[model samples]
Target: MNQLERLRKYTTVVVDSGDIECITRYKPQDATTNPTLILKSVLSKKYDFIVNNAVQYAKKMGGSISQKIQNASDMVSVGFGAEILKYIPGYISTEIDARLSFNTEQCIQKSIKLIDLYRIHGVDVSRVLIKLAATWECIQAAYQLNKLGILCNLTLLFSFAQARACAEANVFLISPFVGRIYDWYKKFCLDSSYDAVTDPGVLAVKKIFKYYKKHMYQTIIMGASFRRIEQILELSGCDRITISPDLLEQLKTQNFSFARKLDATKIVTVVDQPIPLSESEFRFLHNQDAMAVEKLSEGIRQFSCDQIKLEKFLLHTL
Candidate 1:
């Protein structure tokens, strides 16, 4: 079997792209999209129909310019998601605007709007995971949404505090960014050279995985933002893994023996007292992790920039 086949035996493979062709080729169990990916897809000539349909839909709604742009941007996202869902049997994660990360109420509202858009596309809400930045406010937003039976994927996650907080809030899933963590450590640490086993990003995900399993948290840990195939191999047996299309192609072509590196059944039992993290404690602990703090902020800014660009593209079509 190819590496992709072997890895699928241990982890639920999720394609991290908005490109329908890529999703169709890989046929991953689930798929995820962000502003950057959505923008990329919108620029492609192949997806022009989706973009045109979104513009026409926005025009028919007859809102203000800003509202029309927002509507079209959202339609583009949901349009891609709806198309991808036809190929994958599992969930399709549609991210809320990154700019709303700091506003709990806005995050909640945007999530509902995105969910409603998906419904209009004939998608069952059960198969949609509303993706949000893992800010404190967004996390709270997710907590409230979960109570309403809206599952969420808390993204841009870096610190264990973030992971614990999400689990505490009973979030459906958390995407710990593996490649971003590795990039930060490689640039700042004295010794940058490391094998896959010693990679900082790999270690971070492993720590979170062990902690969650040991504490018996039901929150799923899906490792994301991988830099290389080795990182994916190292994270085999994680609850789920979101891999880029290029990496997916690499795994599809490579024939290799794979092993399950993380096993919940094999976690050593220890006296681990679960301490619920209050908002203050969560903030402080997360603040102390410089890598997490920097990466989370950077990730949000990048996504926000991409979202603005996507909105501009939609505005041009309108």
Candidate 2:
């Protein structure tokens, strides 16, 4: 078996792309999209029909221009998600607006709106995982949404604090970013060469995985934003790993001896007394990880910028 096929034996390989063609080719079990990816796919114009349909839906809603733009953006996101779902069997992670990351109520409302759109498209709402930044507010928002049976995939997760908070909130999944963490350390420590075992990003996910398994937390850990195939290989047995199309292609073409690197059943160590974090504790502990703080803020700003650009693109189309 090729590396990709072998990897699938242990991990549910998820395609992290908004491009439907790539999704069709890779055939990942799940697909994930952020504003940047959506913007890239929309701009490619291959899916102009999807964009136009969203525009019409937004116009028929008959709101003010700003509200219309927001509606259209949400529609476009769901439109891609619905299309993606046609090819993949598992789930599609549709993100909420990054601008609402710090606002719990707005995040919850946006998630509801997205889920409603998915339902309107005849897609199963249960197959949609609302993606949100792992801010304290978003975690709280996920808590309430989970109670309502709306599954969430908390993104931009960097620290154990974020993962712990999400698990405590009963979040369905948490995407601990591997590449961004490695990027921060590579620049801050002025070193770029590290093998998979020594990679800081790999180590971060391992720590979180061990802790979660040891405590028997049911929240799924999906290692995300990998910088290399080695990183993905190192996290072979994670619950899920969202890999970009480029890396997925590499895995499909290459041959490698693969082994399960993270097995929950193998985790035996348990903490003496584990306690959930308070809001203040979560913030302080998250803050102590400078890499997490910087990367979380930077990831949000980057996504929000693309989201704004996408809005402008939709406005121009309208």
Candidate 3:
């Protein structure tokens, strides 16, 4: 079997895009969409109707751009996700507003609103994993949401502390960013100063994976934001991998066995360790972790920016 087939035995492949057609080719187990992906899709000629519907939604509001913009955001997500849900048998992740990442209560409230919106159209809540940022507030929100029978995908994770916090809080899953870490090292390093053998992102995920394994945390690890096929291959045994369509297509063309690279059984840690993190401890852990802090902020900003672009598209179409 080829690498994709070989990797399938150990990992659940998830397509990371908004276009259902793009995802159908690889037959990923699940699919994920952020504001960026949806915004990009609406801009493309093939999905212009998404923009049209969102624009009509905005025009009906007939208010300030802010109000219409807010409506536009929701409409885009619901519109794209409604269509995107058809190709995958599993869940489709729909992210909440990134600007709400710091407000635990509002994040939960908005996520619930999103779920209710989806349900109004006969979409099953079980097939939707509300995506939230890995900020302390977002995780807390996910914790509460999970209690309310809502599953969440904690995203923008780049540190072991973030993973530990998410797992400790019993969040459903975490998306450890790989491409952004690679980008950071590539931009910072001189020639020959970097190696995928010791890539910082790889090390981050490995640390989190080992800790999760050692502690028997059930929170799934879905590696995201990969820059290359090698990084995906390196994370072969992760709980799930969300790959972009281009990378998924490339993997389909490759011929070779992709052996599992990270088996938790190979680790030598002898004792089961308990993480004693109260609110104070969780804050301390989150504060001390720079990657989680910085990247979480940056990711939210980028996603929020995409939301703005999507709103602009809605206005012009109106």
> Largest lDDT belongs to which candidate?
2
Please give each candidate's TM-score: 0.97, 0.98, 0.91
Candidate-wise lDDT, in order: 0.93, 0.94, 0.83
| TM-score, prediction 1 | 0.97
Residue 112 lDDT, candidate 2, scale 0-100: 95
Q: Put the candidates in TM-score order, highest first.
A: 2, 1, 3
Q: Would you give me the overall lDDT of model 2?
A: 0.94
Candidate 2, poorest ten consecutive residues by summed lDDT: 267-276
lDDT of 2 at 66: 96
lDDT of 3 by residue, 17-97 (tens): 988678877888899999999877877768777667766876786798777777767877977787777777998999998
> Candidate 1: what lDDT?
0.93
Error of 3 at 73 (Å): 1.8
Please report the TM-score between candidate 2 and the true structure. 0.98
